[model samples]
Target: MKYTDTELEKTLNELGKATYAGEVDVVDKVMNRLKEAENKEKFSIQKERKVRWTIGTMSLAAASVALLLFIGNSSSSQAQNENDGMAKFISEIYNRQSQADVVYYTPDYIDILLGIEGMDENI
Candidate 1:
């Protein structure tokens, strides 16, 4: 399996010489073995290619689903944020109206009395 190029070339050269010297049977056997090896290699390569293609397609589908889910979740969160903003705005307006009503209805004498009481307490 680990033969160098030089060693392989030497072996092929020896086989060629043997075939030329009337060793027909040996040449036939060697050729048959080479053909079998080539057929086996071709089958193995095809099997590997099929497995790789299946894995690649499945990975692509998974990635696409993940991307879609991420986008959907992001849009949902954005919508929730917009709703939260609207709720906060409405709450602030209600608070401001309540405060204005309190200030308008409260008498000046009550305010003066409260301020004096607060000053006395601080002192």
Candidate 2:
């Protein structure tokens, strides 16, 4: 519905006279709620960043642990290879030649401590 100019002027004058004294309080309460919401949003953003950082750090630690474990396994194999000498094979030959004078060791006992012979020892 449309109002005449006089009615509009009268309405403006009544509003200027503060016929709604409680409206300012309502506006302040709404502004405070909006500020609280903004603060909560900022706090949530910070929390999300912390979670992302924690996840990234944990992943990095896990990857480092895995790499260290892999390196340890490789070094252990290399050490076993480096220790391969003539003793075990010589012992095996002597054991077969004189079963009592030398110990009658099993094929597995005579297996190389490092090489593929350990996997399936056939003397």
Give one digit per residue, the lDDT tens place, for model 2 in 22-115: 6344788899999999999999999999999999999999999999999999999787765554556676566565765344554444554325
Backbone clashes in model 1, listed as residue pairs: none
lDDT of 1 by residue, 1-123 (tens): 799999999999998887454534688889999999999999999999999999999999999999999999999999999989878866765566577766553444343533543554566
Sequence-dependent TM-score of model 1: 0.58
- What's the lDDT for residue 30 in model 2? 93
On lDDT, the leading prediction is: 1
Q: TM-scores for all candidates?
A: 0.58, 0.47
For this target, which candidate reaches the highest TM-score against the unseen true structure? 1
Clashes of each: 0, 0
Once superposed on the true structure, which residue ranges of model 1 sit more than 4 Å away at CA? 1-24, 102-123
- Candidate 2 lDDT (Cα, 0 to 1): 0.76
